[model samples]
Target: MHYVKAKGILSAKNGMNLYRGCSHGCIYCDSRSKCYHMEHEFEDIEIKENAIELLEIALKHKRKKCMIGTGAMTDPYIPLEMELGHIRKAMALVCEYGHGFTVITKSSRILRDIDLLKKINDTTKCVVQMTMTTYDEELCRKIEPNVSTTRERFEVLKELHGAGIPAVVWLSPILPFINDTEENILGILDYCARAEVYGVICFGMGLTLRDGNREYFYRQLDRSFPGMKEKYIRKYGDQYMIESPNSRKLMALFHEICRQNEMLHDNAQIFAYLNTFEEKYAGRQLSIFDL
Candidate 1:
Protein backbone atom coordinates (compact mmCIF):
# COMPACT_ATOMS: atom_id res chain seq x y z
CA MET A 1 0.00 0.00 0.00
CA HIS A 2 1.10 3.58 -0.75
CA TYR A 3 -0.28 6.94 0.31
CA VAL A 4 -1.02 9.97 -1.89
CA LYS A 5 -2.70 13.26 -1.10
CA ALA A 6 -6.17 13.67 -2.59
CA LYS A 7 -7.38 17.07 -3.73
CA GLY A 8 -11.03 16.25 -2.99
CA ILE A 9 -13.16 13.44 -1.68
CA LEU A 10 -16.83 13.36 -2.57
CA SER A 11 -18.14 12.90 -6.07
CA ALA A 12 -20.82 15.15 -7.57
CA LYS A 13 -23.39 12.61 -6.42
CA ASN A 14 -21.90 12.37 -2.88
CA GLY A 15 -19.80 9.22 -3.25
CA MET A 16 -16.19 8.66 -2.21
CA ASN A 17 -13.52 6.01 -2.64
CA LEU A 18 -10.83 6.32 0.03
CA TYR A 19 -8.60 3.89 -1.76
CA ARG A 20 -7.69 2.92 -5.29
CA GLY A 21 -6.99 -0.65 -6.50
CA CYS A 22 -7.82 -3.75 -4.43
CA SER A 23 -6.26 -6.94 -3.10
CA HIS A 24 -9.38 -9.11 -3.21
CA GLY A 25 -8.07 -11.09 -6.17
CA CYS A 26 -11.45 -11.63 -7.77
CA ILE A 27 -10.80 -13.15 -11.18
CA TYR A 28 -13.36 -11.04 -13.07
CA CYS A 29 -12.80 -7.60 -11.48
CA ASP A 30 -13.80 -4.88 -13.94
CA SER A 31 -11.68 -2.30 -12.12
CA ARG A 32 -8.62 -3.95 -13.66
CA SER A 33 -9.82 -2.95 -17.13
CA LYS A 34 -7.44 -0.60 -18.91
CA CYS A 35 -10.25 1.85 -19.40
CA TYR A 36 -9.83 2.80 -15.70
CA HIS A 37 -6.14 3.61 -16.34
CA MET A 38 -4.50 2.68 -13.05
CA GLU A 39 -0.76 3.39 -13.04
CA HIS A 40 0.09 0.80 -10.40
CA GLU A 41 -0.60 -2.91 -10.13
CA PHE A 42 -4.13 -3.79 -9.07
CA GLU A 43 -2.94 -5.33 -5.79
CA ASP A 44 -0.88 -2.31 -4.76
CA ILE A 45 -3.63 -0.30 -3.03
CA GLU A 46 -3.36 3.49 -3.24
CA ILE A 47 -4.47 5.18 -0.05
CA LYS A 48 -5.84 8.71 -0.19
CA GLU A 49 -3.97 10.59 2.58
CA ASN A 50 -6.37 13.48 3.05
CA ALA A 51 -9.65 11.65 2.37
CA ILE A 52 -11.12 12.05 5.84
CA GLU A 53 -10.19 15.74 6.03
CA LEU A 54 -11.72 16.39 2.61
CA LEU A 55 -14.86 14.46 3.55
CA GLU A 56 -15.31 16.50 6.71
CA ILE A 57 -14.93 19.73 4.76
CA ALA A 58 -17.44 18.63 2.12
CA LEU A 59 -19.98 17.33 4.62
CA LYS A 60 -19.82 20.53 6.66
CA HIS A 61 -20.43 22.72 3.62
CA LYS A 62 -23.23 20.70 2.05
CA ARG A 63 -26.60 22.48 2.15
CA LYS A 64 -28.63 19.31 2.40
CA LYS A 65 -28.03 15.92 3.96
CA CYS A 66 -28.02 12.98 1.55
CA MET A 67 -26.71 9.48 1.43
CA ILE A 68 -22.91 9.38 1.47
CA GLY A 69 -21.92 6.28 -0.47
CA THR A 70 -18.63 4.43 -0.67
CA GLY A 71 -17.33 1.08 -1.92
CA ALA A 72 -18.23 1.64 -5.55
CA MET A 73 -14.89 1.74 -7.38
CA THR A 74 -13.25 -0.03 -4.46
CA ASP A 75 -14.57 -1.81 -1.42
CA PRO A 76 -14.00 0.28 1.72
CA TYR A 77 -13.72 -2.75 3.96
CA ILE A 78 -10.63 -4.18 2.32
CA PRO A 79 -8.16 -5.82 4.71
CA LEU A 80 -6.05 -2.66 4.63
CA GLU A 81 -9.00 -0.86 6.21
CA MET A 82 -8.40 -2.77 9.43
CA GLU A 83 -5.02 -1.08 9.76
CA LEU A 84 -5.85 2.42 8.37
CA GLY A 85 -9.35 2.80 9.84
CA HIS A 86 -10.31 5.33 7.14
CA ILE A 87 -13.78 3.89 6.61
CA ARG A 88 -14.45 3.98 10.32
CA LYS A 89 -13.36 7.62 10.55
CA ALA A 90 -15.45 8.57 7.49
CA MET A 91 -18.61 6.93 8.81
CA ALA A 92 -18.11 8.57 12.19
CA LEU A 93 -17.96 11.92 10.42
CA VAL A 94 -21.12 11.12 8.50
CA CYS A 95 -22.92 10.19 11.68
CA GLU A 96 -21.67 13.33 13.45
CA TYR A 97 -22.95 15.47 10.57
CA GLY A 98 -26.30 13.62 10.61
CA HIS A 99 -25.94 12.32 7.05
CA GLY A 100 -27.21 9.00 5.72
CA PHE A 101 -24.75 6.32 4.70
CA THR A 102 -24.60 3.37 2.32
CA VAL A 103 -21.83 1.01 1.24
CA ILE A 104 -21.46 -1.76 -1.33
CA THR A 105 -19.05 -4.45 -0.24
CA LYS A 106 -18.43 -8.19 -0.33
CA SER A 107 -16.40 -8.28 2.88
CA SER A 108 -17.69 -9.29 6.30
CA ARG A 109 -15.07 -6.92 7.77
CA ILE A 110 -17.86 -4.35 7.61
CA LEU A 111 -19.22 -5.91 10.76
CA ARG A 112 -16.51 -4.05 12.65
CA ASP A 113 -18.42 -0.78 12.14
CA ILE A 114 -21.90 -2.08 12.91
CA ASP A 115 -22.30 0.26 15.87
CA LEU A 116 -21.67 3.37 13.75
CA LEU A 117 -23.91 2.05 11.00
CA LYS A 118 -26.75 1.43 13.43
CA LYS A 119 -26.18 4.86 14.94
CA ILE A 120 -26.45 6.51 11.52
CA ASN A 121 -29.60 4.50 10.68
CA ASP A 122 -31.30 5.33 13.94
CA THR A 123 -31.46 8.98 12.95
CA THR A 124 -31.23 8.78 9.17
CA LYS A 125 -30.57 5.85 6.80
CA CYS A 126 -27.80 3.29 6.48
CA VAL A 127 -27.99 0.63 3.80
CA VAL A 128 -25.55 -2.24 3.37
CA GLN A 129 -25.25 -3.66 -0.13
CA MET A 130 -23.44 -6.97 -0.62
CA THR A 131 -22.63 -8.92 -3.76
CA MET A 132 -23.61 -12.58 -3.98
CA THR A 133 -22.76 -14.01 -7.39
CA THR A 134 -22.27 -17.69 -6.69
CA TYR A 135 -24.18 -19.49 -3.96
CA ASP A 136 -22.15 -22.65 -3.96
CA GLU A 137 -19.43 -22.17 -1.36
CA GLU A 138 -16.75 -23.98 -3.35
CA LEU A 139 -17.51 -22.14 -6.55
CA CYS A 140 -17.71 -18.83 -4.72
CA ARG A 141 -14.32 -19.47 -3.19
CA LYS A 142 -12.88 -20.24 -6.61
CA ILE A 143 -14.14 -16.94 -8.06
CA GLU A 144 -13.94 -14.59 -5.07
CA PRO A 145 -11.01 -16.27 -3.39
CA ASN A 146 -9.81 -13.47 -1.13
CA VAL A 147 -13.10 -12.13 0.21
CA SER A 148 -15.89 -13.46 2.36
CA THR A 149 -17.75 -16.50 1.03
CA THR A 150 -21.44 -16.40 0.08
CA ARG A 151 -22.53 -17.95 3.40
CA GLU A 152 -20.48 -15.43 5.42
CA ARG A 153 -21.98 -12.53 3.50
CA PHE A 154 -25.45 -13.99 4.00
CA GLU A 155 -24.81 -14.04 7.72
CA VAL A 156 -23.67 -10.42 7.56
CA LEU A 157 -26.95 -9.50 5.85
CA LYS A 158 -28.94 -11.28 8.54
CA GLU A 159 -26.98 -9.41 11.21
CA LEU A 160 -27.61 -6.12 9.48
CA HIS A 161 -31.32 -6.92 9.37
CA GLY A 162 -31.24 -7.71 13.07
CA ALA A 163 -29.68 -4.31 13.68
CA GLY A 164 -32.60 -2.64 11.84
CA ILE A 165 -30.32 -1.67 8.93
CA PRO A 166 -31.68 -2.62 5.51
CA ALA A 167 -29.49 -4.68 3.16
CA VAL A 168 -29.37 -5.03 -0.61
CA VAL A 169 -27.87 -7.89 -2.57
CA TRP A 170 -26.08 -7.51 -5.90
CA LEU A 171 -26.47 -10.80 -7.76
CA SER A 172 -24.38 -10.15 -10.81
CA PRO A 173 -21.44 -11.06 -13.06
CA ILE A 174 -22.57 -14.66 -13.05
CA LEU A 175 -20.02 -16.53 -15.11
CA PRO A 176 -21.57 -18.29 -18.08
CA PHE A 177 -21.17 -22.08 -18.34
CA ILE A 178 -19.61 -21.94 -14.88
CA ASN A 179 -22.09 -20.67 -12.28
CA ASP A 180 -25.06 -19.72 -14.48
CA THR A 181 -27.42 -22.42 -13.32
CA GLU A 182 -30.93 -22.64 -11.90
CA GLU A 183 -29.61 -24.02 -8.63
CA ASN A 184 -27.02 -21.25 -8.23
CA ILE A 185 -29.51 -18.43 -8.78
CA LEU A 186 -32.11 -20.09 -6.57
CA GLY A 187 -29.65 -20.60 -3.77
CA ILE A 188 -28.60 -16.92 -3.74
CA LEU A 189 -32.24 -15.81 -3.89
CA ASP A 190 -33.04 -18.09 -0.99
CA TYR A 191 -30.30 -16.41 1.03
CA CYS A 192 -31.68 -12.98 0.19
CA ALA A 193 -35.15 -14.06 1.23
CA ARG A 194 -33.89 -15.51 4.48
CA ALA A 195 -31.82 -12.42 5.23
CA GLU A 196 -34.89 -10.26 4.54
CA VAL A 197 -32.90 -7.99 2.23
CA TYR A 198 -34.59 -4.80 1.04
CA GLY A 199 -33.74 -5.55 -2.62
CA VAL A 200 -31.76 -7.66 -5.08
CA ILE A 201 -30.03 -5.91 -7.98
CA CYS A 202 -29.44 -8.22 -10.92
CA PHE A 203 -28.63 -7.17 -14.48
CA GLY A 204 -29.57 -10.50 -15.99
CA MET A 205 -27.51 -13.68 -15.85
CA GLY A 206 -24.14 -12.75 -17.33
CA LEU A 207 -20.76 -11.11 -16.84
CA THR A 208 -18.95 -8.44 -18.87
CA LEU A 209 -15.41 -8.91 -20.15
CA ARG A 210 -13.36 -6.22 -21.84
CA ASP A 211 -9.76 -5.97 -23.03
CA GLY A 212 -7.83 -5.91 -19.72
CA ASN A 213 -10.27 -7.85 -17.52
CA ARG A 214 -11.01 -10.36 -20.28
CA GLU A 215 -7.34 -11.20 -20.71
CA TYR A 216 -6.84 -11.55 -16.95
CA PHE A 217 -9.98 -13.67 -16.66
CA TYR A 218 -8.84 -15.91 -19.46
CA ARG A 219 -5.46 -16.30 -17.79
CA GLN A 220 -7.09 -17.23 -14.49
CA LEU A 221 -9.30 -19.63 -16.37
CA ASP A 222 -6.24 -21.25 -17.85
CA ARG A 223 -4.80 -21.70 -14.37
CA SER A 224 -7.96 -22.78 -12.53
CA PHE A 225 -10.29 -24.24 -15.16
CA PRO A 226 -8.22 -25.45 -18.05
CA GLY A 227 -9.69 -25.22 -21.60
CA MET A 228 -12.45 -22.83 -20.44
CA LYS A 229 -10.67 -19.82 -22.01
CA GLU A 230 -10.72 -21.55 -25.40
CA LYS A 231 -14.45 -22.14 -25.02
CA TYR A 232 -14.99 -18.45 -24.17
CA ILE A 233 -12.89 -17.33 -27.16
CA ARG A 234 -14.74 -19.68 -29.51
CA LYS A 235 -18.10 -18.36 -28.35
CA TYR A 236 -17.71 -14.74 -27.28
CA GLY A 237 -14.75 -13.66 -29.45
CA ASP A 238 -14.06 -10.21 -28.00
CA GLN A 239 -17.69 -9.47 -27.24
CA TYR A 240 -18.16 -7.13 -24.28
CA MET A 241 -21.26 -8.54 -22.67
CA ILE A 242 -20.70 -12.26 -22.30
CA GLU A 243 -24.17 -13.50 -21.45
CA SER A 244 -25.25 -16.91 -20.36
CA PRO A 245 -27.12 -19.12 -22.79
CA ASN A 246 -29.62 -19.77 -19.99
CA SER A 247 -30.15 -16.04 -19.38
CA ARG A 248 -33.85 -16.03 -20.21
CA LYS A 249 -34.68 -18.99 -18.00
CA LEU A 250 -32.58 -17.66 -15.15
CA MET A 251 -34.10 -14.15 -15.38
CA ALA A 252 -37.65 -15.52 -15.43
CA LEU A 253 -36.93 -17.44 -12.25
CA PHE A 254 -35.26 -14.40 -10.67
CA HIS A 255 -38.26 -12.12 -11.26
CA GLU A 256 -40.74 -14.76 -10.11
CA ILE A 257 -38.85 -15.37 -6.86
CA CYS A 258 -38.39 -11.67 -6.09
CA ARG A 259 -42.07 -11.01 -6.83
CA GLN A 260 -43.08 -13.82 -4.50
CA ASN A 261 -40.76 -12.54 -1.78
CA GLU A 262 -41.98 -8.93 -2.13
CA MET A 263 -38.43 -7.67 -2.65
CA LEU A 264 -37.39 -4.87 -4.99
CA HIS A 265 -35.93 -6.37 -8.19
CA ASP A 266 -35.84 -3.34 -10.45
CA ASN A 267 -32.39 -1.75 -10.63
CA ALA A 268 -33.73 1.80 -10.91
CA GLN A 269 -35.90 1.48 -7.82
CA ILE A 270 -33.08 0.01 -5.81
CA PHE A 271 -30.65 2.72 -6.92
CA ALA A 272 -33.19 5.33 -5.91
CA TYR A 273 -33.50 3.78 -2.49
CA LEU A 274 -29.74 3.77 -2.06
CA ASN A 275 -29.38 7.38 -3.21
CA THR A 276 -32.34 8.89 -1.36
CA PHE A 277 -31.73 10.02 2.22
CA GLU A 278 -34.55 10.45 4.70
CA GLU A 279 -33.97 12.32 7.93
CA LYS A 280 -36.06 10.62 10.59
CA TYR A 281 -35.81 13.21 13.39
CA ALA A 282 -34.05 16.36 14.52
CA GLY A 283 -30.47 15.69 15.59
CA ARG A 284 -29.80 16.39 19.23
CA GLN A 285 -27.76 19.52 19.75
CA LEU A 286 -24.85 19.55 22.15
CA SER A 287 -25.34 21.85 25.11
CA ILE A 288 -22.46 23.59 26.92
CA PHE A 289 -23.22 21.61 30.08
CA ASP A 290 -22.91 18.33 28.17
CA LEU A 291 -19.70 19.48 26.58
Candidate 2:
Protein backbone atom coordinates (compact mmCIF):
# COMPACT_ATOMS: atom_id res chain seq x y z
CA MET A 1 0.00 0.00 0.00
CA HIS A 2 1.10 3.56 -0.78
CA TYR A 3 -0.34 6.98 -0.07
CA VAL A 4 -0.49 9.84 -2.59
CA LYS A 5 -1.99 13.31 -2.42
CA ALA A 6 -4.99 13.62 -4.66
CA LYS A 7 -5.43 16.75 -6.76
CA GLY A 8 -9.19 16.62 -6.41
CA ILE A 9 -11.80 14.33 -4.91
CA LEU A 10 -15.30 14.56 -6.25
CA SER A 11 -15.93 14.32 -9.97
CA ALA A 12 -18.48 16.55 -11.69
CA LYS A 13 -21.13 13.93 -11.03
CA ASN A 14 -20.40 13.96 -7.26
CA GLY A 15 -18.74 10.54 -7.40
CA MET A 16 -15.42 10.04 -5.64
CA ASN A 17 -13.02 7.09 -5.34
CA LEU A 18 -10.94 7.37 -2.16
CA TYR A 19 -8.55 4.77 -3.52
CA ARG A 20 -7.23 4.34 -7.05
CA GLY A 21 -6.27 0.64 -6.80
CA CYS A 22 -7.87 -2.26 -5.00
CA SER A 23 -6.76 -5.30 -3.02
CA HIS A 24 -10.06 -7.11 -3.54
CA GLY A 25 -8.31 -8.92 -6.42
CA CYS A 26 -11.41 -9.61 -8.49
CA ILE A 27 -10.25 -11.69 -11.46
CA TYR A 28 -12.54 -9.89 -13.92
CA CYS A 29 -12.20 -6.37 -12.56
CA ASP A 30 -12.74 -3.80 -15.30
CA SER A 31 -10.69 -1.28 -13.33
CA ARG A 32 -7.67 -3.43 -14.27
CA SER A 33 -8.31 -3.09 -18.00
CA LYS A 34 -5.41 -1.69 -20.03
CA CYS A 35 -7.64 1.10 -21.26
CA TYR A 36 -7.73 2.46 -17.70
CA HIS A 37 -3.92 3.03 -17.66
CA MET A 38 -3.27 2.02 -14.07
CA GLU A 39 0.54 1.95 -14.03
CA HIS A 40 0.98 0.09 -10.75
CA GLU A 41 0.13 -3.44 -9.71
CA PHE A 42 -3.64 -3.90 -9.37
CA GLU A 43 -3.33 -5.07 -5.77
CA ASP A 44 -0.89 -2.37 -4.63
CA ILE A 45 -3.81 -0.36 -3.15
CA GLU A 46 -3.19 3.34 -3.74
CA ILE A 47 -4.65 5.55 -1.06
CA LYS A 48 -5.81 9.09 -1.86
CA GLU A 49 -4.50 10.70 1.32
CA ASN A 50 -6.25 14.02 0.74
CA ALA A 51 -9.60 12.67 -0.49
CA ILE A 52 -11.59 13.43 2.65
CA GLU A 53 -10.51 17.07 2.81
CA LEU A 54 -11.17 17.54 -0.88
CA LEU A 55 -14.60 15.98 -0.55
CA GLU A 56 -15.44 18.25 2.36
CA ILE A 57 -14.50 21.25 0.23
CA ALA A 58 -16.49 20.02 -2.74
CA LEU A 59 -19.58 19.33 -0.64
CA LYS A 60 -19.52 22.73 1.05
CA HIS A 61 -19.32 24.61 -2.25
CA LYS A 62 -22.07 22.65 -3.97
CA ARG A 63 -25.18 24.82 -4.44
CA LYS A 64 -27.64 21.94 -3.98
CA LYS A 65 -27.57 18.58 -2.25
CA CYS A 66 -27.42 15.46 -4.38
CA MET A 67 -26.49 11.84 -3.94
CA ILE A 68 -22.72 11.41 -3.55
CA GLY A 69 -21.59 8.12 -5.10
CA THR A 70 -18.48 5.97 -4.71
CA GLY A 71 -17.21 2.42 -5.10
CA ALA A 72 -17.48 2.29 -8.86
CA MET A 73 -13.83 2.22 -9.88
CA THR A 74 -12.66 0.56 -6.66
CA ASP A 75 -14.24 -1.17 -3.73
CA PRO A 76 -14.73 1.34 -0.92
CA TYR A 77 -14.51 -1.31 1.81
CA ILE A 78 -11.22 -2.83 0.72
CA PRO A 79 -9.07 -4.44 3.45
CA LEU A 80 -7.06 -1.22 3.81
CA GLU A 81 -10.25 0.67 4.66
CA MET A 82 -10.30 -1.04 8.05
CA GLU A 83 -6.94 0.59 8.72
CA LEU A 84 -7.21 3.94 6.89
CA GLY A 85 -10.94 4.50 7.57
CA HIS A 86 -11.11 6.77 4.53
CA ILE A 87 -14.51 5.48 3.48
CA ARG A 88 -15.85 5.91 7.00
CA LYS A 89 -14.50 9.46 7.12
CA ALA A 90 -16.08 10.27 3.77
CA MET A 91 -19.45 8.90 4.95
CA ALA A 92 -19.18 10.94 8.14
CA LEU A 93 -18.72 14.06 6.03
CA VAL A 94 -21.72 13.21 3.84
CA CYS A 95 -23.90 12.57 6.89
CA GLU A 96 -22.72 15.76 8.64
CA TYR A 97 -23.73 17.82 5.63
CA GLY A 98 -27.09 16.00 5.33
CA HIS A 99 -26.25 14.79 1.84
CA GLY A 100 -27.69 11.70 0.26
CA PHE A 101 -25.21 8.87 -0.37
CA THR A 102 -24.93 5.71 -2.40
CA VAL A 103 -22.28 3.05 -2.94
CA ILE A 104 -21.63 -0.04 -5.05
CA THR A 105 -19.43 -2.73 -3.54
CA LYS A 106 -18.66 -6.45 -3.45
CA SER A 107 -17.49 -6.72 0.16
CA SER A 108 -19.54 -7.51 3.23
CA ARG A 109 -17.27 -5.12 5.14
CA ILE A 110 -19.77 -2.39 4.21
CA LEU A 111 -21.89 -3.61 7.12
CA ARG A 112 -19.74 -1.41 9.37
CA ASP A 113 -21.42 1.72 7.94
CA ILE A 114 -24.99 0.49 8.21
CA ASP A 115 -25.73 3.00 10.96
CA LEU A 116 -24.48 5.94 8.92
CA LEU A 117 -26.24 4.69 5.81
CA LYS A 118 -29.53 4.55 7.68
CA LYS A 119 -28.92 8.02 9.11
CA ILE A 120 -28.31 9.53 5.67
CA ASN A 121 -31.31 7.72 4.31
CA ASP A 122 -33.45 9.10 7.12
CA THR A 123 -32.48 12.63 6.10
CA THR A 124 -32.70 12.07 2.34
CA LYS A 125 -31.63 8.79 0.68
CA CYS A 126 -28.89 6.21 0.92
CA VAL A 127 -28.86 3.18 -1.33
CA VAL A 128 -26.40 0.29 -1.02
CA GLN A 129 -25.62 -1.62 -4.19
CA MET A 130 -23.78 -4.95 -4.12
CA THR A 131 -22.50 -7.21 -6.90
CA MET A 132 -23.24 -10.94 -6.66
CA THR A 133 -22.13 -13.17 -9.53
CA THR A 134 -21.34 -16.63 -8.25
CA TYR A 135 -23.84 -18.60 -6.21
CA ASP A 136 -21.40 -21.34 -5.42
CA GLU A 137 -19.41 -20.23 -2.39
CA GLU A 138 -16.08 -21.79 -3.45
CA LEU A 139 -16.24 -20.33 -6.95
CA CYS A 140 -16.81 -16.87 -5.49
CA ARG A 141 -13.67 -17.17 -3.42
CA LYS A 142 -11.71 -18.37 -6.45
CA ILE A 143 -12.68 -15.39 -8.63
CA GLU A 144 -13.10 -12.54 -6.16
CA PRO A 145 -10.43 -14.20 -3.97
CA ASN A 146 -9.80 -11.80 -1.12
CA VAL A 147 -13.24 -10.24 -0.80
CA SER A 148 -16.36 -11.57 0.90
CA THR A 149 -18.01 -14.60 -0.64
CA THR A 150 -21.36 -14.35 -2.46
CA ARG A 151 -23.35 -15.79 0.44
CA GLU A 152 -21.88 -13.25 2.84
CA ARG A 153 -22.77 -10.48 0.43
CA PHE A 154 -26.29 -11.88 0.28
CA GLU A 155 -26.44 -11.71 4.05
CA VAL A 156 -25.41 -8.05 3.85
CA LEU A 157 -28.23 -7.42 1.42
CA LYS A 158 -30.68 -9.04 3.83
CA GLU A 159 -29.37 -6.92 6.68
CA LEU A 160 -29.76 -3.78 4.56
CA HIS A 161 -33.34 -4.77 3.85
CA GLY A 162 -34.02 -5.22 7.57
CA ALA A 163 -32.55 -1.75 8.15
CA GLY A 164 -35.03 -0.24 5.73
CA ILE A 165 -32.10 0.84 3.58
CA PRO A 166 -33.11 -0.02 0.04
CA ALA A 167 -30.54 -2.14 -1.78
CA VAL A 168 -29.63 -3.22 -5.31
CA VAL A 169 -27.82 -6.32 -6.56
CA TRP A 170 -25.44 -6.22 -9.51
CA LEU A 171 -25.56 -9.49 -11.49
CA SER A 172 -22.73 -8.54 -13.76
CA PRO A 173 -19.70 -9.85 -15.69
CA ILE A 174 -21.30 -13.32 -15.88
CA LEU A 175 -18.03 -15.00 -17.03
CA PRO A 176 -19.63 -17.22 -19.68
CA PHE A 177 -19.24 -20.94 -19.01
CA ILE A 178 -17.99 -20.43 -15.50
CA ASN A 179 -20.95 -18.90 -13.68
CA ASP A 180 -23.51 -18.23 -16.37
CA THR A 181 -25.45 -21.39 -15.74
CA GLU A 182 -29.15 -21.48 -14.80
CA GLU A 183 -28.30 -22.89 -11.39
CA ASN A 184 -25.99 -20.01 -10.53
CA ILE A 185 -28.35 -17.32 -11.84
CA LEU A 186 -31.39 -18.77 -10.09
CA GLY A 187 -29.54 -19.31 -6.85
CA ILE A 188 -28.45 -15.67 -6.77
CA LEU A 189 -31.90 -14.51 -7.79
CA ASP A 190 -33.38 -16.53 -4.96
CA TYR A 191 -31.14 -14.64 -2.56
CA CYS A 192 -32.15 -11.32 -4.08
CA ALA A 193 -35.82 -12.14 -3.85
CA ARG A 194 -35.44 -13.12 -0.22
CA ALA A 195 -33.44 -9.99 0.49
CA GLU A 196 -36.11 -7.90 -1.21
CA VAL A 197 -33.59 -6.04 -3.32
CA TYR A 198 -35.10 -3.04 -4.99
CA GLY A 199 -33.04 -3.55 -8.12
CA VAL A 200 -30.76 -6.00 -9.95
CA ILE A 201 -28.46 -4.52 -12.59
CA CYS A 202 -27.48 -6.92 -15.38
CA PHE A 203 -26.06 -5.30 -18.49
CA GLY A 204 -25.88 -8.66 -20.23
CA MET A 205 -25.20 -12.31 -19.68
CA GLY A 206 -21.42 -12.04 -20.15
CA LEU A 207 -18.14 -10.56 -19.03
CA THR A 208 -15.96 -7.95 -20.72
CA LEU A 209 -12.26 -8.70 -21.19
CA ARG A 210 -9.59 -6.47 -22.64
CA ASP A 211 -5.80 -6.26 -22.37
CA GLY A 212 -4.83 -6.12 -18.68
CA ASN A 213 -7.85 -7.95 -17.26
CA ARG A 214 -7.97 -10.33 -20.20
CA GLU A 215 -4.41 -11.51 -19.64
CA TYR A 216 -4.89 -11.81 -15.90
CA PHE A 217 -8.15 -13.68 -16.35
CA TYR A 218 -6.59 -16.05 -18.86
CA ARG A 219 -3.67 -16.73 -16.57
CA GLN A 220 -5.95 -17.53 -13.66
CA LEU A 221 -8.22 -19.68 -15.79
CA ASP A 222 -5.29 -21.76 -16.93
CA ARG A 223 -4.01 -22.11 -13.39
CA SER A 224 -7.35 -22.95 -11.82
CA PHE A 225 -9.81 -24.20 -14.44
CA PRO A 226 -7.21 -25.54 -16.91
CA GLY A 227 -8.01 -25.63 -20.65
CA MET A 228 -10.45 -22.78 -20.01
CA LYS A 229 -7.97 -20.24 -21.38
CA GLU A 230 -7.69 -22.07 -24.66
CA LYS A 231 -11.46 -22.38 -24.83
CA TYR A 232 -11.82 -18.62 -24.31
CA ILE A 233 -9.10 -17.66 -26.79
CA ARG A 234 -10.57 -19.93 -29.41
CA LYS A 235 -14.12 -18.73 -28.81
CA TYR A 236 -13.46 -15.04 -28.20
CA GLY A 237 -9.98 -14.04 -29.27
CA ASP A 238 -9.43 -10.32 -28.78
CA GLN A 239 -13.13 -9.76 -28.24
CA TYR A 240 -14.33 -7.29 -25.63
CA MET A 241 -17.61 -8.88 -24.58
CA ILE A 242 -17.19 -12.58 -23.92
CA GLU A 243 -20.84 -13.52 -23.72
CA SER A 244 -22.09 -16.78 -22.27
CA PRO A 245 -23.21 -19.45 -24.70
CA ASN A 246 -26.38 -19.59 -22.59
CA SER A 247 -26.80 -15.83 -22.82
CA ARG A 248 -30.31 -15.75 -24.26
CA LYS A 249 -31.66 -18.44 -21.94
CA LEU A 250 -29.95 -17.01 -18.89
CA MET A 251 -31.14 -13.51 -19.74
CA ALA A 252 -34.70 -14.76 -20.06
CA LEU A 253 -34.48 -16.44 -16.67
CA PHE A 254 -32.91 -13.28 -15.15
CA HIS A 255 -35.74 -11.08 -16.39
CA GLU A 256 -38.51 -13.42 -15.36
CA ILE A 257 -37.11 -13.81 -11.87
CA CYS A 258 -36.61 -10.09 -11.35
CA ARG A 259 -40.01 -9.21 -12.78
CA GLN A 260 -41.68 -11.75 -10.55
CA ASN A 261 -39.95 -10.24 -7.56
CA GLU A 262 -40.87 -6.69 -8.67
CA MET A 263 -37.23 -5.77 -8.76
CA LEU A 264 -35.96 -3.05 -11.06
CA HIS A 265 -34.34 -5.13 -13.79
CA ASP A 266 -33.84 -2.26 -16.22
CA ASN A 267 -30.37 -0.73 -16.02
CA ALA A 268 -31.55 2.84 -16.69
CA GLN A 269 -34.36 2.68 -14.15
CA ILE A 270 -32.08 1.30 -11.46
CA PHE A 271 -29.48 4.01 -12.13
CA ALA A 272 -32.20 6.65 -11.94
CA TYR A 273 -33.29 5.23 -8.58
CA LEU A 274 -29.76 5.44 -7.24
CA ASN A 275 -29.28 9.04 -8.40
CA THR A 276 -32.69 10.37 -7.45
CA PHE A 277 -32.78 11.93 -4.01
CA GLU A 278 -36.13 11.84 -2.27
CA GLU A 279 -36.56 14.43 0.46
CA LYS A 280 -38.38 12.07 2.79
CA TYR A 281 -37.47 14.25 5.76
CA ALA A 282 -37.86 17.58 4.02
CA GLY A 283 -40.97 18.64 5.94
CA ARG A 284 -39.80 17.91 9.46
CA GLN A 285 -39.77 21.00 11.72
CA LEU A 286 -39.09 22.00 15.29
CA SER A 287 -42.47 21.98 17.01
CA ILE A 288 -42.83 23.92 20.25
CA PHE A 289 -45.58 26.43 19.51
CA ASP A 290 -46.88 26.58 23.06
CA LEU A 291 -46.16 30.26 23.55
Top-lDDT candidate index: 1
- Residue-level lDDT of model 2, residues 1-291, one tens digit each, is 888898999888889999888887788888988888888887898888889999999989889989999999999998889888999999999989878999999988999989999888887889999999899999988888999999999899999999999998899879977998999999999999999999899989999888888888888898779898998988999999888999999999999999898988999998998888666544442245522
TM-score of each: 0.96, 0.95
Pairs of colliding residues, candidate 1: none
* lDDT for predicted candidate 2 compared with the true structure: 0.89
Each model's lDDT comes to 0.93, 0.89
lDDT of 1 by residue, 1-291 (tens): 899999999999999999999989899999889998888988999999999999999999999989999988898888999999999999999999989999999999999999999999988999999999899999888888999999999999999999999999999888989999999999999999999999999998999997799988998999889999999999999999999999999999999999999999999999999999877754543355554
Local lDDT at 112 for model 2: 92
Query: What is the alpha-carbon lDDT for the whole of candidate 1?
Result: 0.93
lDDT of 2 at 172: 84
Highest TM-score model number: 1
